[model samples]
Target: MFPLSLLFGFYFVQFSSAFFGTGGIFGHVLRYQKLCLCRCGVSGVTQFPDSFSNVRLLDGQSVSPHQFPWLASIKIDNRTIAGALISDKHVLTAASPLYGIPPNRVSVTLGLHDGCTRNPALSSSIETVILHSAYVSGYSYNDIALLRLRHVVPFSQFISPICMPDFRTLESDQVASTLSWKWAPNSVSCTPRVATLPILPVWTCLLNRNSDTITPNKGCLGPLGIKSIVCEDDVGAPVMSRQPYSSSFRLVGVVTTANCDHTSAPYYTKVAYHAAWIYEQIRDDCQCFSI
Candidate 1:
């Protein structure tokens, strides 16, 4: 087994640099997610501390600005969507924001927590917005997209990429974490809140959705109590999780639709289902393929 120091060092530097800088061990996303499959594997190692405990104490509890450095905020024309920083130059988000719209108008801001104060953070021109090819128009399946930044985003306490889960090992019972930002009442600024919720059983009413256009590319979260139902404004927000015995948090889902009243469960685009597609887009764009 590699020393803890070696693993931690790899967590921050190697994982980011090699994957983004073309140094070493950069493989497909799904395989990367399977790194923890071995009980005593190197991927079984973890880096960061848990943001909080397993309990879902409150719905909109205030989150410290420095937490969840991978948080991303995207703006297109007049609309705003939440995103997760998956890599140095890549941001993962919901494709619903891009449906029927051109990618040229999008811009992403990293490291910013409070928009009202115009607090310090990073911003970049979006080089390209790649939407999932299987995404259906006006529906929830495959509701994912990627934004390629013009340059790499430097890592900092307030900014870093979220870890990718080992898809091979994640169980349905995995705990899910999500952060929500609501526009201040009658104001333009947003206040960030954290919510912990349950993932619906693999077979749910939503899975039997009547729409022929809907695909099996999404997951359902909650039947959360009335006060905690995800609202319309939270669309595109990330639903994240930490693997057993690992401190790294990974993107699990992206909010597609939520009733906000807790009656109907909210739907999210399943990140695992698109792991292959994600690796392809990033690898091809980075031109990381070898001869």
Candidate 2:
């Protein structure tokens, strides 16, 4: 099995060169892989249990293993951060974790509800790290990123991808949430936390200092008061929302920047705005993923 990945690694190198010559989707692939390409199963519409039989959330961590299957963890620099499994081959997160860490040092672990406590069976190696083209050193608006796994994650009761939202379905003043694990003040263990916040108008997020960077592509999680909900290590937490009639939760934004003050809503990069860029990374056109 390892040899199979290595075999593709060779072809990936060749195809990547040809991809560079084309300079279209190839550029997106180039930006994502950062010279090293990896994979898991390419793509598929997966089935997940709408109702978890034995799952609960205490703070920001799930009580059972399969409670929140789409919630995954990115491990780098001996620190584990939150992320969401958007597909079998891709996990969505903020650009902060990958900023200074070496790509090879990162891995995404799925199917485990308690990310802070134990190692899970379903882990994928990092293949590529793609940050938004407009991302800068300190600015956080365009902070969304994709991590392509080196191997396919077998979908199971304990592992699945979250739903991707269509902009048309997200009406104004919709309720969205952040599902993550947090370490509280003076607490030894982290617990699963859930904080549902209203999707504020983009204009509201722009009223702050340096708010000119606010665009339709960003989301604000304030106006709901959540200082008691979010934790210091909860960055990259998925901003999720359930469709009106759907049981499964879809990913809407990522925890890019947040405030310890509930008075101030945190900032997240709206996933809908980058829908096109995201599709380009996971789509079959790249020839980077194999089932």
Q: What are the TM-scores, per candidate, against the unseen true structure?
A: 0.75, 0.72
User: Which tens-of-lDDT digit does each residue in 46-125 have in candidate 1?
Assistant: 33336554435345456667577777888889877788887667888888877776657888898887977868989988
* Number of clashes found in candidate 1: 1
**TM-score, cand. 2 vs. native:** 0.72
Model 1 steric clash pairs: 33-166
Candidate 2 regions exceeding 4 Å error are: 1-64, 116-120, 183-191, 207-210, 224-228, 285-291
User: What Cα-based lDDT does every candidate model obtain?
Assistant: 0.65, 0.66
- What's the C-alpha lDDT at position 102 in model 2? 64
Please, what are the lDDT tens digits per residue for candidate 2 over residues 105-137?
A: 998877665545665557778888888787776
**Residue 198 shift from truth in candidate 2, angstroms:** 2.0
